[model samples]
Target: MRFLFIVQGEGRGHMTQAIAFYHLLRSQGHEVCGIIVGKSKRREIPDFFSREIKAPIHLVDSPNFVADKKQKKILLGKTIRKNALMAPTFWKSLKTIHQVVESRNPDVILNFYDLLGGLYNFLFRPNSRFWVIGHQYLIHHPEFIFAKGKPWDKFLFQLNTHLTALGAVQVLALSFLPKNDLINSKFRVVPPLLRKEVRKLEVKTEDFFLAYMVNPGYGEEVLAFAKSNPLVKIKAYWDKKSAKPIEYPLPNLSFHRVNDQTFLQDMAACKGLACTAGFESVCEAMYLSKPVLMIPVAGQYEQACNALDGEASGAGIASNSFDFSLLEKAEKKDTKVSFQFHQWVDSWPNILSELIVSAEQESGVKNPDGEFDSSPVFG
Candidate 1:
């Protein structure tokens, strides 16, 4: 079946997931016709995307999280106002997506939890099928456990997840651990898609604690931690565009801009991994058998759940602040959990194939080879 991807270009996780899934589908005899990525003036599509993804990538304006002056916490009030101001541009971008889908008439519009899928279904009311793929969607599973935090924040986050799934035929929730006894079988739980570059790496233990800060505001905490612990080497990667790599005078801590290949290699060999509790990074850390120390971004409830879940999966500890000291204990715990997660990762391909066939059948479109009316019969 022909598929088109709608990705939220807010972070590396979704973008990498799209690239990995694109290749996976192609390998299974499905064609990815086009990719529409939601982006903003504040951020451009990462360079690796154009070179790595086989399909053409189109960037369209979308709402972005606005950070406060420190650029660390997501200011929810400010974020809403900023996106409200850009409503016109965002609307036009959705219009462009509508035309693309209408012209291509793809059998499935695979959404990487982009907000546009809902808007497009509401505006154009097209016959296309949408499958929302993201770890965030796992929040709605009846048997899924959420992190303990502010009740309001958890509610808002779940509401946002449902909004992203508006008109979606299925929510292919990506997970770090396996929970097959989900109360809502309407949604399928699948393993996180680690970038192929990451999965192929030869794992080892090195001297450093590799770190990534999704919001550069967290950089201050990293610097403070590195200063306090002078002996532990820390190599961190950030998306601080227009900034040169810095080798701190502290002698053991250095910050470099994100380079996917280098990051994966460093993660594979690093003594431990530290980053915001984004689902994909935690999954990669687990896949590499590296211990994790997660600090969820302030005001992002989805990440709070990830931190709780990651720790529950035996990955590591979570901190409200940058406590790199936890790496020592967390690394050993992750070792115990790695085998179970590996089983989940190995199960995705088969489960995903079944999902694709079901989605295509409901789409009322012929399978790619036209031999089956709706079932995806692989070559």
Candidate 2:
């Protein structure tokens, strides 16, 4: 079967998931014909994604959050106003998506939580089997735990989740641990889509701590903390386009541009990790048996939920700030929990293969080898 991917380009998590899924599909003898990624003016498609996906990538104008001057907190009012002003551009993007879908005519359109993908399906009503993949979709699960308070934030988060899954036939909710499938619903709980590189890494403990911050503004907090504790060594990565590849302002503190190989190598050997509460990195750390300090970007409700969820799953402790000291103080994850999480992650191949076959069968689509049957297959 042929597949098309539509990914949200806001952060590293979604793109990483796309890359992992792309490889997974190819391994199963499916072809990824094309990819349409939601893009904003502030960010560029990471080189690693382009190299790994190895498919035609088209970027289109899409809604993105407006961060403060320091790029620390997301300003809700300003974000809504800014995207509202970009209505025309986003409309053009939707048309582009429709054009691609009509031209490619793939058996499946896998949406990685991009708003435009969902919008295009809703308005254009394409023929392909639509499936939504993201951790945010887990919010509707009855047993899911939410962060305390912030009613408005929770509402907006759910609203976005709903919009991204407008016409989805199957919603794959990526989880840290296994859970029962949502009965009589379109939701299925699945493990994280970690890339092959992450799974092959040789884990170890080193002296220096590692950090990954999506909003470069959080670097200020890390820098301040580094200065206060000059004896502690730190290696951090960010997507600051203007910064040099590697900068060492202090003997014990250094910053590097986000490079996939270097980041994974560092992660494998680091003593601990301090990163935003994005699902991908936390899961990576958990799989590597490294403790983490997760700080959700302010005003990103999905990330807030991730922090709570990560804490619950023994990934690490969540914090409102990038305080390495807190990570140092926290207890290490239980060996049993680490073993269980690893076992859960390793089960992705079987779980995902069943899901793909079920989705294709439900849509009455032929396999890549041209095998087709109308009889429904039970999952």
Candidate 3:
């Protein structure tokens, strides 16, 4: 079977998921014909995608969030306005998606929760079967707890999830903690898609912490912490524009641009991961049996939910700020959760096979070549 991956190129999370699934499909004798990633002005298609995925990647303009002056919080109004102004570009990108799908003639299309993927499906109504995967879909689960006192934020975040999952036949909801499937809905609770490199790291008990910040503002908090504790060392990764290699901001702190290998190596050696509550990084930290101090990005309800869920999953404690004091107290995290996590991670091939086949049959689509991955969606 042939597949095409449509990814949201906002951060390393979606792209990393795509890389993992691409390898999984190939290992199962399926071909990934092409990849289409939605691009944002603030982000660059990371080197890892091309260096690792081994697919012809197509990048096109898509809607993205606009951050505030501090680059910490999402400016919802400004974001909508900016993307509204780029309406013409997005429309063209939609058409481009149609052309790619048509030319690739994939057996199935997988969406990594890309907004353009949902919009294209909703508007273009292409005949190809589509499956949507992301931790965001877990929001729809009955047992899924959301952050309180932010009904409006939760509503908007869910709206975005629905938009990205608009026409999906199967919604693969990645979970921080396993829950029962959504009864009578096109949702399945699946393990987080952790990269192979992360799973294979040789972890060491180091003294310094690994800090990953999607927003640059969090670095100041880390820097402030470092200033107070002059002896403690911090290695932080940020997507700061035009940043030099070694950004020596404070005596005990250094900031590096987002580099996959460097980040993974640091993850192996760090005492704990002090970062935002993005699903992917937390999962990676857990797989390495490293504790985390998660600070959810401001106004992102999804991250708030992730922070809470990650805590429940025994990833580490959650904080509203980058306070390294918490790291010292919680340095020796338990390894018991890792056994269950690895068990869940190992089950993806069979689970996804079942879901893909189920989606194809439910959509009433069959291949012209009489080839179908009729394997059971579950063992």
Best by lDDT: 2
- Please give, for residues 78-160, the per-residue lDDT of candidate 3 as tens digits: 88899999999999999999999999988778899888888888888776767789998887788787899988888889888
lDDT of 2: 0.87
The TM-score of candidate 3 is: 0.93
Among all windows of 10 consecutive residues in model 1, the one with the lowest summed lDDT is 370-379
Clashes of each: 0, 1, 1
Per-model CA lDDT versus the true structure: 0.79, 0.87, 0.84
Error of 3 at 116 (Å): 1.2
Each candidate's TM vs. the true structure?
0.92, 0.94, 0.93
For model 2 the local lDDT of residue 42 reads: 65
What's the CA RMSD of model 2 in angstroms?
3.9
For all the candidates, what are their Cα RMSDs to the real structure? 4.4, 3.9, 3.9
Per-residue lDDT of 1-379 in model 1, one digit per residue for the tens?
8899999988788988998898788778999989999885555577788888888677788767888788788888788788889889888998899889988898788888887776676567666666678988777566567867588777777776776777666678787777674554456778888767876899888889999988878888888888889998999888776557565646888888877888899998898888998888888888888888889899887788888888777778888887877777653544446777777787767876888777655555655776434221110
